[model samples]
Target: MSPTLTFALAGNPNSGKTTLFNSLTGARQHVGNYPGVTVEKREGRLRAAGRDLILVDLPGMYSLTAYCADERAARSFLVEEKPSCVIDVVDAGTLERGLYLTVQLLELGAPVVLALNMMDEVRRRGLSLDTGLLARLLGLPVVATVARLGQGTDDLVRQALEYAKARRGQWKPLELSYGPDVDRALGVMAARIEADRFLTDRFPARWLALKYLEADEDVIVLARGRGPTAAFLEETAARLARHIRETQATYPEAVISDYRYGFIAALLRRGVLQRTASPDRLAVSDTVDRVLTHAVAGPLIMLAVLFCMFQLTFLTSRYPMDWLEAGFGWLGEAAGAALPEGLLKSLVVSGVIAGVGGVLGFVPLICVMFFLLSCLEDLGYTARMAYMLDRVFRAFGLHGASVMPFIISGGIPGGCAVPGVMAARTLRSPKERLATILSAPFMACGAKIPVYLLLIAAFFPEHPGMVMFGITVASWAAALCVAKLWRATVIAGHSTPFLMELPPYRLPTLRGLLIHTGERAWQYIKKAGTIVLAISVVMWAAMTFPGLPPDRLADYDAERAALAAEREALPDDGSAQADRQALGERLDDLDNRQTEEALRRSLAGRLGVALESLSRLAGFDWRVNIALIGGLAAKEVVVSTLGTAYDLGQAEPEAPQALSGRLAADPRFTPAVALALIAFTILYAPCFVTVAVMARETNWKWAAFAVVANTALGFAVAVAVFQIARIW
Candidate 1:
C-alpha cells in the first residue's frame, strides 16, 4: 500500500496559518485535545495527485526551540511524526521573521516547500521578490500566494504532493555559529555520543548534538546514552551559563539566534530592495494606533464605542426580545390550555419554551458583541492593543498578547477566564504564561450578563450602559491588579518581547462574517439545546411545588361566608367604600406574600437559601443568593431565576409582582450594592458548562484555579466597589 503523504505547515504566530488551515480543510478538520492535554491537535486530509495528503497545520511558533507551549507542541509533532513533506508557510509581507522558521524547518532534513503566503500584500506594497534567487539560496521550491483569498493554494498543494511523492531532500541550511568554544564542545560530544544511530537518515545527528551543545529542550527528548545523558545535559547547561556570564557574550542559543538573524539580513540585503519606509502592514497599523491607542484619548473612545455597543444590544434587541418572550409565553399558555395539566403541558411550557426563550432573549446581545469583536479583530486594533498595553504589562512580567484575550473577552458576556488561561498558551515563557493565566479570570465573561442585568435593573435602572461599562472596565482593572500581585509574589521572570502582527486594515469578509455570526448564534442555540431545556423544567418544578392545592378557594369561600356575617355586620358604617379599596389592596398584598412564601419552600428556593452562605460576603440577599445558585446552571437563568423567585407565574409578564419594580423599592439593592453585584458577576466563576469546557480546553488544574481565583476576586471586588462607592 502507498504511504499517506504527511504535510506539515509551519509558520510564525499570526501569519494566518490557522486561517489558511481552516480555508483548506474547512469541515474536513477535526479538533481534539492533544494526548492527555488541553492543547488542541489540528489534523486534516486533502487529496492531491490521487493520494491522500494528511496535513498537520502545526501550532504557530516563534521558533522550533520549544520555549513556549505552542512551540513545544509544534516541535514535538515535527520530531516524532517526521511527516513526509514540510510546507513552511511564510507571510510574504513579513518575510524576514517568517523565514526564520523556514530556516529551522530545513534543518530538520525533510522535503520542504516554502509557501510564501500573502503575496498580494507584497505585490501591492510595490515590493518585488526574486523568487528564483530565494529558491536557489534556500535550496527548495517556493510558491507565492495569498492564503486568505485562496489564491495559488491549489498550485501550492500540488507542489507539496510532488515533493512528497518524489521524497525530495533539499540543500542543508547555512550553519549558525554558537562561538568557537561551543563548536569545539559540540564536536567532542558528537564523537562520544552513541545515540547517533536513531537520528541518522532523519535530521542531522550533528544538529541533535549541537542542540545538546546549546542544551535546547526540543532536541534532548531524542537523546540517548541514558545514565550519562541527564548528567551531561545538566553539566552542559551550567558550563554554558558560566561561559555566557564570564565572557559576557551570551550562551550558545542566543549566539545561534543572532547568527540566524545575521544570515537572514545578509540574504535580504542581497535580493530584497532596501526601502527607507516601513512595511505597509506596520505603516497602516501605526496610522490607526495613533488614534485608537492614544494614551490620552483611547480610553474615552473605547468607552464611547462600548456605549454604542451596549445601546445596540439593548435598544436594537428589544423588539426581537419582546417578540420572543411574548411568542414563547403565548405558546406556553396555549399548550397549557390545550394539553392536560400534567407532564406534557409542563414540558412544553417549562422545559421547552421557557428554556429556549431565555437563551433567545440574549441573541441580540451575542450577535452585537460578536459582530463588534470580530470587527475589532479584523480592523487590526487587537494587534495594536498589544503594542500599546504590553509595555504596562511588562512591569508585571507578562506579554501584550496576553492583554488581547482579556480585552476581547472583557466586553463580551461569554468571556470565560478558562479560555483566558487557555489563551496563555501563546505566551512563550512559562512564568509569564502562568501569571497571565492566573490573572485572566478578573475579566468578566458573557455568562455573567444575567447577574449584571438583574442587579443593574435592581439598582441603576437608568444607566445600564454606564453600568456595563463600569463592569467591563472593572474586570480588566482587577485583572491588572491580580497580574501585578501574582508577578510580585509567585511569578518571577524576565518578560518576553511582544511581537505583534498587524494585518492590513480592510473591510471584513462578508461570507466570513456571516459564518462567524452564525457560529456564535449556534453557540447560543446549542447551549439552549443542552443546559436550558433541563434547567427550565427543573426551575419550573421548583417554583410549582406545594402548588396552591388547585385553587379550592371557592369551596373555602362558601365555608368562610358562614363565618363572615358578624365582621360584615360590624363593617357597614360610612367607611365601607374606603374599607373596600383597602381590602382590595390587602388582597393583592396577601397574594404576593403567599407566592413568595411558597417559592421559598420549593426545592430550588431551599437550595438557594442553602447556598446563601457563599453570597453573604458579597452582600447578596436571599433572592440574589438564589439567583446566583440558579445562575450556575446557565447565566441567562439569572433573569429566569428572578422571574421564578418573584413567582411571576410561568413567564415574566404574567406575574403581578414585577421583580424590576421590587428591586426599585428594595433597600438592600442600593446603588453601591448594585454596582458591587455587577462587579461580582463580571469576575465570578463561569457557569457549570464553561467550567467543564475550561477544564477540557486547558487542564483541570487551570480549570480549578479559574473557579477559586474568580470567586475570590469577585467577592473582593464587589466589597471594594460597594465600600468605596459609599464614601466617594
Candidate 2:
C-alpha cells in the first residue's frame, strides 16, 4: 500500500522517448490536452517493484527555453508539477547533441536519470559509450537502453526509481562557468535572485539567472512584475549583454550556449566516448538519404510513395468498408421495420441511423490511412518529407516549419485542423505563422475524407486512388498558393530560415502502428457518435416538421386512392398487368412528389433552396446546399447530412440506400459536380473547432478573415471548375 510516484519522460524528438514510454506503459496510457493548452499530454500508470508509478510523456523539445507551445508545456510541467524524477532520454548515436538538453535539465536542478537510448545503433556504428565513466563525470546514474526493442528498460526504470528515492525531492542545481564576464554576471544575478527569493518557489535561483541571461520571455515577463529587483536584474543582464556584444561580437545567449557545449566537449574528451569507425563513413540513414533526399529524384519518390499510400488504403480498406456499410444499412432497415411509422421512427431511422452511419461507414478507410501515415512517421520519413519540401515551402513565402503544420492539418489526408492550427505556433515569425494558420485548413483532413471518398465512389469509381491523389495535390497547391498571396498582401514578412533534425530511419513495430492508428480511429468514431449524432438530430428536425398542409396531404391521399382503385380493377385480369404497373408507377411518382414538396417547404430545405440560385453555378442543388451548410460544423457532417437529406426525400422511409449509391443514381450528380464539390470542400472554411482555435491562437480578426477569404476562394474555384467542365 504505497503512494504512487510520478516520473516525467523528457527528450528531443525521435530520441526513442516515446518508444520507451510505450514499452513502459503499453495499454495503460491515456492522451489529453495539457490544462489550458492544446499541446497533447500523455500519461500512463504501472505497478513496478510493489509501487504504483505514473509516467508522464512530455512533448518532445530541444530545450526548456519555451520557444513553442511544446517547449512551454514541457517546461511548465517540470517546474509546476515537480515530478518525482525527470528521465532524460538521449540518443546514444548522437550523444553530443543529445546531451545539450541534458545539460540544461541538470542545471535546472531536477532529479535526473539518463537513459541512453538507441544503444543498438550506437554499437552497430562501432561506437563505444563508457557509461560508468560518463556517470561518474556527470555525478548521476546513466543506463543504456534500446527502447524500441525493450532492451534494458527494466534496469533504466529501476535506476530512475532509486535515484528519485535517494534525492527525496531535493534539487541541487549544476553550476557551469560561462567564460569570465558572463560568469561574473551570472554570479551577480543569482545572488540578487536568491536574496529576493524571486520565483525561487518554482525555479531555482541559478536557473532563473541563466534564463534571464538567455532572455527567456516567460521568465522575463514574470521578473518584470517583481518590483525594483527585476529592474536590477535586467540592468545587470543588459550590462553583460552589452559587454559580450562589444568584445565577442555576440550576445550573452550565444556565449552561454557555447560554454555549455564546451562543458559537454570537455567531458567527452575524457575518454567517455570512443569511436572505432572512420569518421568519413556514412551511416545507413545518410546512405539512404542520398537518394531519398536527392534534389532531382526525391520529389518524384515522394509523390510515388504518396500515390501508393492512397492506392493501398483504398484497396485494403474496401472490404471492411463494405462490411461496415452493409452492417449499418441492415440496422437501419431493421429499425424502420420494428418501429411504427411516426416521428419517432423517422428520427431513429433517418437522423440517428443514416447520419451517424454514413460517417461510421468510412471508419475502415480512415483507419487504414492513419495506419500507413503512422508507419511513415515512425520510420522517420515524415521529417524527410518536411525537409525536402522546405524549398518549395519557402518559395511560397512560408517557413519550412509550415510544412509540418500543413501535414498535421491533413496534408497527408487524415490530419485534423485544430492541431494543425496549434502546430503553427512552432513557426517563429508572426507573419509566417499567421499565414500558415490561415492556409492549413486547406489540407484534406480526416473529417473531409468521408466526403471525398463518398464522391469518389459515386462519380470516379474507376480511379478512386488517382482521383484522391489529385484532390490531395490540389489541396496542397491551394494552400501554398493562398499562403503566397497572404504573404504578399495581408501578413507580409520575410520567411525565417528553417532548421530541422532528421531522425535516423527505423522499422516501425506493428504494435506501434496499431496503437497510433487505434487512437486516431477512436477519436473519429467518438466524434461521429457524439457531435455527428446530435447535429443529425437537429438537421432531421429542421427537415421534418410542420407535416405538410392538411390540404396537401389530402390531395396526395386522394391521388394514391385513385391509383390503388385503378390498379385493383386492372390487376384482377392477367392481361391488364402492364396497365396495373403503369398505375402503380403513377402512384409512386405522386408519393415522391409529396415527400419532395414537404422537404422543400421545411426550414432547412427552404434555406437550401434560397441558396440554390448561387450554389447552382457550382453544380450544387438545394440538397447539396444543405449538406454544405452543415459542413461548417464538421466536414464529416457533409456525408451525414447528405444521407439524412436523401433519406428524408425518399418515397419509402422503410428502405434506405447507401449515400454513394443514392448520389450516383441522381441525374443531377455528374462527375463535374462531384469534382466541383470536392474542390469547394477542400478550400472552404475549416470546421467550427478549427476556427475557434485559430481565433484563440491569433485573434478574431484573422480567424474571421480565414472564414470569409477561404469560403470565397472555394466558391470561386468550384464555380470555375463546374463551368469549364460543363462546357467541355
Candidate 3:
C-alpha cells in the first residue's frame, strides 16, 4: 500500500464538517466508540492523488478547551495522534467565530488547511472574504466549499494533502500576544518547558504553557504527574494566574480567550472581509425565524408541520403496504402448496414468512417517514422544535437539551429509543438526564410505529392520519407526564438552562436526503432480518410444540372423517352438491378448531392463557398477550409475533388475511381492545436493546426500575382506556 495521509477534520458544531466528511468518505466509513467513553470515533479512508488518505472526523467543538467530552476528545486526538494535517472546517458566514478555533489549532503547531464551508451562505448574505489574503495572513492553505452541494470538496482535499505533504515535520508553533502580563509568563514557562522537554513530545511548549495558564484540568493533571520539573512549571503557572487575577481582576484563561477573538477581529479587518454597510442586516433565515420561532405562532406552526408530515406518510405508504400484504399472502399460499402438511410448512408459513413479512410490510411507511424526517432535519426545523419546546419541557422538569433526546428517541415518529436514550448524555443535570432517559421510551419510535399502524388500520382505518397524529401526541404527552412523575417523586433536581445555536436553514439536497433516508431505512431492515427474525423463530417454536395429545388428535380425525363421510353420502343431484359443500365447510371449520386447540396446548399458548387472567383487565386476550411478550424483545416483534400466532391458529393455513384484517375480523378483538393494545404498546417497557442501553447509560437499578415501572404504567393506562371505552 502507498503511504497513507492521515488528516483530522475539526470544526465547531453545525459548521458543515460532517457534510464534508460524508461527501469525502461515502460508504467507506465506520463509527466506533471512543475508548472508555460513549463518544463516537469516525474514521474513513479515501484514495486520492495516487495515495490513500485516512480521514478522522473529530468531535465538533468551539475551542480546544477541555471542558466537555467533545472538547477533551478532539483536543486529545489532535495533540497525541498528530494527524498529517488538520482541516478546520469554518463556516464562512460566521468567519470571525470560526477563526477563534483556527487560531488555537495554529498554536498547536499542526499543519492546517481552512475548509471555508457554507461559502454560498456567505455570498447570499452579501459578505465576501479574501481567501488569498486570509490564507497568507494565517500562513495556511484556504479552500472555499459548499459541502452540501459537493462544490470544491475535491479541491479542499487536494489542497489539504498538498499542505500536509509540504509541511511534513517542518512545522513550528505560532504564539499570539495575550497582553504584557500573560506573554511574560508564557515566555518564562516556555523556556522551562523547552529546557526539560517537558510534555513537549505531545504538545508544543508554548501551547503547554498556555494550557497551564488557562488552568485546563486534564493538562494540569498531566503536568502534576510529570515529575518535579513539570510540577515546578505548574507552580509557576499558578503564581502567574494569581498575579493576573489580582492585577487585571480576571483570570488568565479569560484574558487569553479575549486576545484570541481580538486576533481574529484584527485579521478580519485587514481587507480580508467586506460586508454590506449595515453590519447587522437580517437575512432570509431571520425573516423565516421571525414567524417560525414566534412565541405564539411557532408552536402552532410546528404542530401543523408535524401533523402534515405524519398525514403524508400515511397517505403515501398505504398502497405499498397493501401490495406487500398481497405479496406475503401469495407467498404463504405458494408455501402451503409446495410443501406437504407438516411441521416444515408450518415453520415456513407461520414462523418465517408471517413473522418477517409482517415487519417488512411496514417498510414503505418507515421509508416515507425517514425521508421526510431527514428533510426536516436537513432544513433545520429540528432545532426549532427544541427551541420551541424548551419551556414546555421545563414544566415537566426536563432541560431544553432533553428535547433533542426525546425527538431522537421518536418524538418525530420514526426515531429509535436506543439513540434517544443515548442522547441523554447532552443533559448536564443528572436528575434531568435520568428522567429523559426513562421517559424517552414512551415516544412513538419506529419500532412501535408498525404496531400502532397495524392496530390503527384494523380499528381506526377511516382516520389513520388522525389516529397516527393522536398516537404521536399521546406519546409526547405520555413521555412528558412520566418525566414529571419521575422528577416529582424519585429523581428531583432543578433544570438546567438550554442554550443551542440554531443553524441557518438551507434547501436540502436530494442526494443528501436520499443518503440519510437510505441509511435509516437500512438500519430498520437490518434489525428485522437479524433481531426480529431470530426472535420470531424462537417465539414460533415456543408456540408450536407440545403437540395436541393423541386422544385429542384422534377425536379431531374422527370428526373430520365423519364430516367427509356425510359429504360423500349426499345424493348426486344439485341439492346434494350444495349439501356436500356445506359438509365440507363444516369439515374446514373443524380443522381450524383443531389447529386452535393444538396451539392452545403448546408452550407459548399455555403461557399466554395463564397470563390472560391478568391481561384481560387491559382487554388483551391470550393471543395478544403472547405477542406483547414478544415485544419485550423488540417492539417490531409484536406485529410479527401476532402474525405468527394468528396464522398458525386461524382457519386458513394456506391463504390468510393480513394481520390487521385478521385482528379486525376476529370476534374476540374489539375496537376497545385495539385502542387498549395501542396504549399499552405505546407506554410499555422499552425493547430489550433500549433497556440494555439504559443500563449502560445509567445503572442496572434504574434499568430494572424502568421495566417494572413502565410496564405497570402502561398496563394501568391500557386498562383505563378499555374500561372507559366499554363504559361508554
Candidate 4:
C-alpha cells in the first residue's frame, strides 16, 4: 500500500491559493476553526498518481512571523504539524513580495513545491520569468500555473506528490547567511540549542536561534521554559543586538530581513527576471487608478458608486420583491382556506408564512446587493475605497484598516456584523480594535438590509433610491460619530497608519460570480427555513397564548351580535342594501378592534404595551415594539416579527394585503413613525450573534457596554426624530 501523504498549501492573500485548493480538492473539503483560535481551518483530500493526499489550506499570510493572528497560525501549523510537503502558491506578477513568504517557508525546512500562479497577469504586464532557473535557484520544483483558469494545476499537484513521497517525515531546515555579524551569533546559539535540544522536536535549533534574534515573543517564551540555557542564548542575542544597533543603526530583525531580500535580488539577477518596461507605467490597473484614486475625484466617484449601487438594488429588486409578496400572500390565503380557522391555521399563515416568508421575500434584494458588492470586492475597488478614506478615518481616530471591518459589517448595507466584528482583529491597537468592533455593528448589515428596505418601501415609496441612500449615509455618520465618542472616552488612542495592496481589477468569471451569489442567496433562504422558522414559531406562541379574557370576549361578541341583529332587521329592498353594507362595514371594524385587543392581551403584546410608555415617544406602537424586540435576536427578524404581528392584529378584510400595504393602511403607522422606526433600527444594538461575537473578540464588559450604549443612543435619536417630525 502506498503511504498517504499530507501537504500544506500556503500563500499571501490574493495569490490565487484558494482557487488552486478548490481546483485540487473540488467539493471534498471541510471548513472549521483552528482549536482555541478564530482563524479558519480548511482541509481537503485528493487522490493523484495512485496516492491519497491530504491538502491543508493554511491562512493567507505575508510571512511566518509571530506578530499577527494569521502569521502565528501559519507558523504554529508548520512547526507543529510538520507536513510532508508545502506547496507555496506565488503570485507571478508580485514575485518580490510573494517570495518573502517563500523564503520563510524554505527556512522552516519544509520540502517545498512552488506554484507560480497568475502567469497570465505576468504575461499581460509584458514580464517574463525563467521558471527553470528560478526553481534551480530556490532549490525546489517551480510549476508555472494560472490557478484561476486551472492551467498547469495538474502538473503542480504531480510535482507536490513526488516531493511528498521523497521527503516524508524528514526535513533539513534551509540556512541563509545574514552577514558575518549575525551568522557568528547564530552559530553560537545554535550550538547551545542543539546541546540542550531546546524545542528541537518542534523547531530546528538554528531556526530557533534565528527566531530569538528576530525577538519573536512566542519563541522567546518557549526558549525561556527551557531554563538556564535560555538565559545564555538571550544574553548572546542582546550583546549582538547592541553591537549591531551601535554600528549599523539597525536591529537583528532588520539584519535578517535585509539579507533575505538580498538573496532574492541576487537570485532574480541571474537571468531569471526579464521585463520589457517599468511594470507600473505600462499596467492598465495603474491607468485606471490614476483617475479612480484621484484626490478630488476619488471620494466623489465612491459616493456615485454607492448611489448607483443602491439605485440598482432598489430598481432591480422591486418587481421580484412584489412577486414574492404576492406569492406569500397567495400561500397565506391558501392556508387560510384549507385549514379550519383556529390556532393551527393561524400558526401556518401568520407564524410560518407571514413571519419566515416575509424574510424570504427580501432574498432577491439581498442577492442583488450581494452580487454587486462581490463584484466591487473582486474588482479590487473596495481596497481603493479604504485607501481614499484613510485620511478621513485617521481624523476620526480610526485606522484606515477599520474601513474593511466596517464595510464587511454592512458598511455597504448588505453585510453582516459577525464577520465585521471579526475583521477588527486586524487592528493592532486594542483601543482602535474595540472601537471598531463597537462601531462596526452600526453599519447596515445584510440582516438590517431587509428591515430598511421594507420600511423604505412602506413609507418613502416615492423615492426608495434616495431614501435607501440616506439610510446608508445615516449608518455611516452614526458609526463615525460613535467611534469618535468611544475614542474620546473609553478606548482612546492615537490612530495607526494603514497600508494595503490593491489587487489589479479583472473581469470576474461568470461561474465564480454565480457560485458566490448562489451561496449567499441560499444562506438567506436556509436561515428563513430554519433559525427564523423556529424563532417565528416561538414568537407566534408568545403572541397567541392566553386568549382574550372571557369578559372582554363576551363584550365583543355582544356588540357583534347587536350589529348582526340590526342588519337582519332591515327590509328586503334596494334601499336596505346600503344599510346592510354599512352594518357589514361596522362589523369588520368591530372584528379588527377585537383582534387588536386580543393581541395586546397576549404575552408578546403585553410586553410591548409595558414598554409603550417609553417606546411611544419614538412613535412606536406596541406592535412595532414587539418587532423591535425580536430584532435583538437578528435584524431581519424585525421584518418577520412585524409580519407576524400585523397578520394577527388585522382583520380578515386586510388578510390579502402585504405587510407594507397593511402598515400603510393602519392609522397608527404614519410616515413620521416609519422614519423614526428606521432611525432606531439603524442604530440599535447588534444582533445576538454579533454581540456574542463581540464578547468573544473583546470581553463581556465591552459587549454589555455596546448593547446598553447603542440601544440608549438609538432610542434617544429615535425619540428626537419622532418629536421633530411630529411638529413638521
Candidate 5:
C-alpha cells in the first residue's frame, strides 16, 4: 500500500491560505474541533500519485508560540501530527509580512514550500518578485499564482507531493543571532531540560527555555515532569528573564522580531533589481480610516452605519416578509376548506401548518440581515470595525481580534460561537481568551431577531423600525457592560496589548460572499422550518382547548358563519368591512384561545404564567411577562407565542393591523412594560445551543455562571429601564 502523505497549509491572515485550501480540496473539506479546544479543525483529502494526501489547514497566525489559542492549537498539530510537508501560503502583494510567518514555519524543521499567492495583485501594484531568488534564500520550493483563480494551486500540490516523497527523518534547527550572552544562556537551559521528543525539534529548545523563565503557561504545562531537569531549567530561565528585563529595553520576542526585519531589509536590498514605489489603495483606505478611527467620529460612524444597515434590513425585507406571511395565512385557509374540524384537521390547520409555516415566514428578513453582514465581511471592512473598537474592548480586558467570534456568533443558533471562542486563541493571554468566551453571547443573535420584531410590532406599534434598532443597540451595550463586569470579577485581568492587520479594501469576491450568505441563510431556514416548527406545533397543541370534538365544532361553525355575515353587512365605508372580516377571524381564533386558557391551567402555560408572575414583580404584566418566559428556549418564540396567543387572545381583529398590532394597543401594554421586555430580551442569555457551546468551549462551570449572571443582569437591567422610563 502507498503511504499516506500529510500536508499542512499555514499562513498569516488574509494571505489567501483559505482560498488555496478550497482550491486544493474543493468541497471535500470537513470542519471539526481540535480535541480539547474550540479552534476549528479543517481537514481534507486530495488524490496524488495514487495515494491519499491528507491536507490540514492550520489557523492563520503570525507565530507558533503557545501564548494564544490559534497559535497553540496550530502549534500542537505541527508538533504532534508532524505533517510530512508544510505548504506556506504567502501574499505576493505583501511578501514581507507574509514571509515573517514562513520563516517561523521553516524554523520548526518542517519541509516548507512557499505558495506566493495573489500574484495578480502584485502585478497590479507594479511589484516584480524574483521567485527563484526567494526560493534559494528560504531553501525551499516556491510557486507563484493567484489562488482565487485556482492558478498555481495544482503546481503547489504537485510540488508538495514530490517533496514528501524524498523526506528524511532529520532536519536542521533554526539558527538565530540573540548575541553571545543570550545564546550561552539558551544553551545552558536546553542542556538542563528534558521534555517530549516532539518539542525537541518543532520549537527552538532555547526559545522554550526563555518562555519557561517568564513562567509561560504553555511552557510550564508541557514541561510538567522530569522533576530535577525541569526545576533546574525553570529556575535558571526565571533568573535569566529578570536579568534581561533589568538590562534590556525590550522583551525577547520584540528583539527577535526586530532582528528578523533587519535581516529581511538587507536581503531585499540585495535581491531586488530596482526598488520602485507603486501607487497603492493603501493610501485611500488609510485616509478614510483616519476619520473613521477618530475617537469621536469613529463611534458616531459605527452607530450611523449600524442604524442604516438595520434600517435597510427592515425596509428592504418588508415586501418579501409580508408576502411570506400572507402565503402562510392562505395555506391555513386552504387546510380549513379541505379538512373537517378534528384532531388531524386542527393539527394541520393550526398545529403543523400554522406552526411550521409561521416560522418559515421569517426567512426573508433573516436572509437580508445576514446577506448585508456577509458583504461587509467579504470586503474585509468588518475587521477594521474591530480595530476601531479596540480601545473600548481593551478597557474590558479584550483585544480587537476577540470581537470577530462574538460578532459572528450573535447571528444564529449554533452560530460562529465555537469559532468565535476559538478566535480568542489569537490573544497572547489565556485570561483574555477566557474572558472573551464568557461575554460573547450578549449580542442580540439572529435567533432573537424574530422575537424583537414581534415584540416591537406588538409593544411599540408607533415605530417598528426604531424599536428594532433600539433593541439591537441595547444588546451591544449590554454586551459591553457584561464584558467589563466579567473582567472585573470573574476573568480578573487586563488584556495583553495586541495589533490587528487591516486588509486593503478590495471588491468582495462574489462567489465567496454568496456562498457564505447562503450558508448562514440555510442555517436560519433549517431552524425556522424544523426546530421552531416543532416548538410552534407543541405550543399550538397546548393552545387548543380541553376538547376539540362534536359539541365545539357546531358552535364554532355557527359563530364563524354569523361573524362572516356581520362583517359583510357593515356600512360600505371599506374599513367597516375590514372590521367585519376581523370579527369573523376572531371567531376562528376562539378555539386557540380555549386551548391556551387550559394550558395556562395545565403544565406549560402554568410555567409561562409563573414566569410572567415573577416578571410582574419587576413591573411587567402577564402578556409582556409571557413573552419573556416563552423567549427562553428561542427568542423568535416570542413572535410565534404572541401570534398563537393572539389566536387564543380575543380575536376581534380591527382594521388592518397584524395580531401583534392589537396586542401593542391594549391598555395593559404600556410603553414602560414594552421597553422593559425589550431590555430583558436584549441582555438575557442566549438559548441552549449557545450555552452548550460556551460550556464546551470554556467548560461547563463558566458556561453555567454565564447563564446565571445574565439571568440576574437581564432582570436588573430590565427593571432599571422600566422604572427610569416610567418616571420620565
Candidate 6:
C-alpha cells in the first residue's frame, strides 16, 4: 500500500544513460511528448524491495543551462515536477567532462545518486577510479556500472531507492565559492531571494542566485514577474557582471564555470582518481579513428558502408517482400471474386487492399534498412559521419550539427522529417538551422522508399541496390546544393563553428538494435494500415465516381456481349482456337477503353488531366499526376495511389499484378519516365505532418516556402532528367 516514488534519470549525450534505463525498465517503458513541448519523454515502472518506483528518463543534456530545448525540458522537469531523486549517469572513463553536468545537478539542489558507467572501458584504458573515496569526497553514493551488459544495475537501483527514501523529496543545494567579489554579490542576491521568498517554493535560493549569475533566460523571465525583489536581483547581477567584465575581461557565467570545474578538480585530487598509464596514451578509439576519420579515406569508406547497407537491405528483404506481395495479391483476388462488381467491391479490393498492400509489401526492406542504420548509430560511427561531413556542411553554409538533422530526415533512407526538422533546434545559428530544416526533406525517407523501390524494380531491376545508392547520393547532393543556394541568397549568414564529441566505438547489442528497428518498422506498418488506407479509399472514390455515361457503358456492354456470343459459337473446336483468341482480345480491348474513358471522366482523373500538360514536360501522364498529387499528403500515398489507379484500370482483374510489374508493362511508362518520377519524389515537398512540424518549429511562411520551392525545384529537375534521358 505504498505510494510510487518517482526517480529522474539524467546524463550527458552518449553517457550510456539510455542503455541503463533500458536495462532497468526492459519492456515496461512507454514514450510520449513532454507537456506542451515536442521533445520526447520516456517513463517506466518497476518494483524493487516491494516498493513501486517510476523512472522518468529526461532528455540527454550536457548541462542544466536551459539554452536549448532539450536542456530547457530537463531543467523545467527537475524544477517543477520535483522528482524524488535524480540518478546522474556519468562516463567513468572521462570523469572530468562527465561530472560537469553532475555538478550542475548538485548546485540545483536535487538529490543525486551518481551511476559511474563504462567502468569496463575505464579499466581497459588502465585508469582507476576510487569509488568509496570519490563518494565520500562528493558526499553522494557512487555505483560503478556497465549499463550495456546490465552490470551493477541492481545495485545502482538499490542505492538510488535507499537515497531517495532518506532524502524524502528534500533538496540540499551545493554552494560553491566564486571568489571574493562574486561571493559577496551572491551573498546579497541569496539573502534578498530568501528574505523575499522569490520563487523559492520551486527552486532553492542559492540555486536561483547561481542561475541569475549565469543569466539563464528562463529564470530571468520568471524573475521579471516577481515585483521589486526581481529588480533588486537583476541590479545586483548586472553590477557583478559589469565588474567582472572590467576586471577579468570575461563575464560572470565564465567565472562561475571556472570555479565549478576548480571545485571538481580539488575533489578529484584527494586520491579519488588515478591513471596507471601515461595520459597521452592512445586508446582503442583514437587508434581506430586514425583510419576511420582520415581525411582522404573516411569519405570513401563512408560511401562503401552506405552502398553495402543498401545492397544488404535489398538482398535480404527480397524473399520476405515477395511473400508479402503474393499474399496481398491473393487476398485482393479473393475479395474481387467474393464481392459483386460495384463500389463496395472496388473499395475493398482495389482501394483498401491494393493501395495499403503496395506500401506494406516494402515493410521488410524498411526494417532491414532501419536495423542497419541503428547498428551504425549504436556503434558510434554515425557521429563520426557527422564529424567527417562537417567540413562539407560548412562549405555549403551549414553547421556541422546540421548533419544529424539531415541523417534523421532520411539521409540514410528510412528517417522521418518531423523529428529531423525538430532536431534542427540544436543548431545555434538561425540561418543554418532554417536551411537545414528546409533542405532535410530532400533525403529519401521511408515513405519515399516504396516509390523508389517500385520504380527501380520496374526499370532498373538489374542493379536495384546500385540504383538505390545512386538515389541516396542524389538526395544528399540536392540537399547540399539547395542549402548552399539558400545560404548565398535569402538565408545568408555566417556559418557557426562546429564542435561535437564523438563517442568511443562500441559493439551494438542485439536487443537494443531489435527494439529500435522494431519500433520504427511498426510505425511504418501502422501508417500504411491507417493513413494510407484512408487516403487510398478516398482516391478510389475520386477515380471511380461519375461513371462513364449509362449509354457509353451500354455500348461497351453490347460489344462485350457480341464478342462473347461469337467466342461461345467458335470455341468448341480445336481448329477454331485462333478465332476465339481474336474475339477475346477484342473484348479485352473494348473493356480497357471503357475503363480508361471512365477514369478520365472521374473527379481525380479530371484534375490529373488538367495538370497533364505541365506534368508531361517531366514525362508524367494524367495517371501519374494523380499519384503525385496524393504524395503531397504523404510520400507513401504515391505508391498506394498508383496501386489503386492501376487496379481500377486493369482489364484482367482476375490476376492482380504487382504495382511494379504493372508499371513496367505500361506503354506510357519507360526507363526515362521512371527516372524522372524517382527524381521528383526525392525532391518534392515533405508529407503534411512534416510541413506542420516545420511550421511549428519555424513559421507558416517558411513552411509554405518549403512546399512551393521544393515542388518547383523537383519539377524542374524532373523535366531536365526526362528530357536529357530521352535524348540519350
| lDDT string, candidate 3, 555-661, tens digits | 99898888888777778888687777878889888978988988888999999999999999988998999999999999999999999998889757545478888
| Cα-lDDT of candidate 1 | 0.67
TM-score to native of every candidate shown: 0.85, 0.92, 0.92, 0.96, 0.86, 0.92
User: Per-residue CA lDDT of candidate 1, range 1-728, in tens?
Assistant: 56677788888876878777877787888876656445778898787767777788888887777777677788777776777778888877788888888777766566788888877666656678777788888777888777779987898888788877666434344455556766666665655554634455545655666666556765666554545755565576568668876897666677777777888888888975344345544545457767887886876676677667776666666566556556666666676677876656655655556545555656666676677667766666566656667777877667787886676455344455455657767776767777776666556665566556556656776777777777777766777877787777756667778777766665678777777777867876676667766776677677667554445445444444543543365466676767656655555555555555556666766776776686655667677776666676677676666554543332222422334555667676677767777777666777776677666654688768777877777788887877788777
lDDT string, candidate 6, 346-410, tens digits: 88988899899999989988999999999999899989999999999999999899999999999
Q: Give candidate 2's error at residue 604 in angstroms.
A: 1.9
Full-model lDDT for every candidate? 0.67, 0.91, 0.89, 0.88, 0.70, 0.91
Candidate 6: residue 679 lDDT (0-100)? 89
lDDT of 5 by residue, 22-80 (tens): 88898888999887877889999889768898899999887766556777788889877
Off by over 4 Å in 1: 168-188, 194-203, 218-248, 272-282, 290-319, 322-326, 329-356, 396-398, 411-414, 454-461, 486-504, 546-591, 610-619, 648-673, 693-709, 716-728
Q: Is candidate 4 or candidate 5 better by TM-score?
A: 4
> What's the lDDT of the predicted structure labeled candidate 3?
0.89
Comparing 3 with 5 on TM-score, the higher-scoring candidate is 3
Q: Rank the candidates by lDDT, best first.
A: 2, 6, 3, 4, 5, 1
Predicted structure 6, TM vs. truth? 0.92
Model 6 stretches astray by more than 4 angstroms: 26-32, 195-197, 225-247, 276-281, 330-345, 429-431, 487-492, 562-580, 654-656, 699-701
Estimate candidate 3's RMSD in Å.
3.0
Which portions of model 5 show Cα errors greater than 4 Å? 168-170, 187-217, 235-248, 272-283, 411-419, 458-465, 544-596, 617-630, 649-657, 665-667, 723-728
Q: Best candidate, TM-score-wise?
A: 4
Identify the superior model by TM-score, candidate 2 or candidate 6.
6
